[model samples]
Target: MRIDPALRALRSNPDSQRIAQTALETCKSGWRSAEGNASIFAELIRYGRGDELGECPALSSLFADLDRAAALVEDLVSQILPQIAAHPLGQVPFRHQYSGGMAVLQLAAAGDAALSLVMYERSGDTPHSPTICFTDTERHEIALAGSGTMQIVRRNRGRRAPAELSVSSVEMKSGQNLSLCGMFETKRIESVEERLVILRLGRTGAAPEPSLEFRVADGELVHQASGDKRDSCHELMVSLLGRMGRCDAAPVLAEMTRSGSDHLRWQALRECLALDTATGFTALCGIARNPADTLSANAGSLRAQLIEAYPELAAFEKTLCLA
Candidate 1:
């Protein structure tokens, strides 16, 4: 019979050790869940002091869940980003594209294990907390991409939506104490007990995500949703893929610079520079002679920058190279 030091401290603490187990259950349900995440997270952070939840070996299971979830998100991005960018609509518009919460993937056949999302409000009978997990696994690999808004809930079955995410991290502290996000944005009674409820969140420079995401099961489009948002998402992916130096993205960038959407020609040209300088230069030459001042000026400006770096482009001084 043996007990870990961290677990021992949690149990002996006057507050309560059950709080740790509760938080573990919360993680089990899924961090994506809407269940009073903002408040529960705060509690976990406050009570996780010492070995209670921080160093307690008993709570290892919960930590494992967190790690696995993170890996899932990372893998999804790495595998599906290229696929999304390769969509036909992905190459035209640059800064603008549709994001209809769609997903394109490579499937084995059908019914392979897959990941999807369900956004249900706190209606009666529905689970009060948001939940996310693998629905099926009949395929070889799984991946996904997109954005979705996660509600920050105050009450378990809160009808009003205004929940924010936060955390505390002793392992990754910046200066003196654990960092947090979207916390203390409300007026609530202050108590050491209440503060102990939050999770120890750390700082991140991540940007905002979309309001909906689609899973890429196989090498095909699954789920049924596509509109401006999805198209926009695709276009953004195309531009991003070009920047990633994906040679496969060259054709798309070149095409965009040639006959794509008029408003996005500049973006296509920019991507082409990275993917195919020849095509990009040709596009610039065409724009350089156009009547539109903005279009011609932009081409001239970009040409100047390129010329400074690539003296070889200076050979085109007689054509499109800026003085």
Candidate 2:
């Protein structure tokens, strides 16, 4: 493999201590150049052993320097490995390629114990191919680099609400790829609901992103709203009901019509007529047949408009019509 100028400079340095210090600092800073760091470490090990470079006073110092650099690298890995292993997105094997090389790491959590990690490395211009691994007797495959994006998907099977399960996606850094995606379901479950959370971390210049979804039975979709405000889901549902008659959203319209709130009842009445003729007509019949019920004035006006627009509502209008 060809060495970059930065790697070449670190390899040729006469002072091993300075070279090792720089390597430690780069790793500490979470450097974007993984290939460069790996190359420098490989060279440092070769020189420290006095195999690649002739013996000299610097060789003894090089050994100590290399040791310190290796320790730092191990420390950095130790701290990050646990977090990656526990991450829902990190549970899968992932691989990515950049201009120089690629890395593949498989992650798994061992019951309450430490995480299990298996890492692979390769260098070249071509992308890495997909690989497979097993966890809890199940097998999964990781995608080839530059194929499509990888995501973590969670499915709930128990009698709990759909919102109880969570799913998410994470993006790998350039030259870094995801090698596997796995599915995990807990056996020792809890009663509290769960939501899908996706965590994405990119290269140093790239921003981290996350997406969440809450699903309920009967095709109810609740999207998270922007800002720190609480109750966004309920707020969004209310806003959607307000603009009903304009869109063909039958589920939410049905929900609004069944709502006990008078405001929601009025909104649903206006939107239902534009949704579907059969369903809208049936809803109007229910209101006309129960004119004594406390429906808002707006709801009543909408009923009147339905009669005027569709003469079919004329018979029920007599029963609901008030002087």
Model number with the top TM-score: 1
Give the whole-model CA lDDT for all candidates, comma-separated.
Answer: 0.38, 0.38
**lDDT of candidate 1 over 1-323, digit per residue (tens):** 79987557666783543444444334433532334333333433333332233443322222335443334344434544554443322222112222322223211011111122211122223232222111111111111122112222121122222222222212211111221122121111111111111112222112212122122222121232222243356568777887688776666766665553444556667777777777668777777777664578777777788889989877865554454
TM-score of each: 0.27, 0.23
Q: In model 2, where do residues sit more than 4 Å from their true spots?
A: 1-235, 238-252, 315-323
RMSD in angstroms, all models? 22.9, 22.0
Which parts of model 1 have CA positions greater than 4 angstroms off? Answer: 1-231, 259-263, 316-323
Pick out the ten consecutive residues of candidate 1 with the lowest summed lDDT: 134-143
Residue 278 in candidate 2, Cα distance off native in Å: 2.7
